[model samples]
Target: MTAATFQWLTLVTLTALTFSVAETGLSGSSILIPVLLATLLKGRLVIDRFMALQGVSGPWRWVVLGWLLLVLGLIAYTFLYS
Candidate 1:
């Protein structure tokens, strides 16, 4: 499949995974894993697809990816550890 189609699939899967995780009534470690996966998928799609960073060159793509990673990291840390 093309990159665009793959990205769309990733988004749909993330949505389903997030919803299932919320509905399953999980707690502790089990719960944290799916949430983290979904968050990472969102970051990947945002950087590689929605923002079109994958089509860019040099420092621009890295800068965007780095910023997204930082935000996603902070969110995951807060959600799991705090």
Candidate 2:
């Protein structure tokens, strides 16, 4: 299998897992944390693959990834604190 194929599969699997968790209709920190983590992974995949930032050896990749992490971290913190 090719790298692209593997990444596609990983994205699909992560999306399904997140969707299943949502369908459970249980919104607690414990459950939401996993969902958020899955979202973070999905975001990374998109930023790397769809955004064409993977293996580029530049600051742009880290900048984008850092932004993603910050956004997700705030979301998770809010969920946990509230």
Indicate which candidate wins on lDDT: 2
Candidate 1 residue lDDT tens string, 17-68: 8888889888776787768767777887887778887877679878877877
Regions of model 2 farther than 4 Å from truth: none
lDDT of 2: 0.88
Winning candidate number (TM-score): 2
Q: Which segments of model 1 are wrong by more than 4 Å?
A: none
Q: Write down the TM-score for model 1.
A: 0.72
TM-score of every prediction relative to native: 0.72, 0.84
User: What digit string (tens of lDDT, one per residue) describes model 2 on residues 1-82?
Assistant: 9878898999999989888888888778858889888888889889998888989987999999999999999988888888
Where does the lowest 10-residue lDDT sum fall in candidate 1? 28-37
Error of 1 at 62 (Å): 1.8
* Overall lDDT per candidate, in order of appearance: 0.79, 0.88
**Candidate 2: clashing pairs of residues:** none
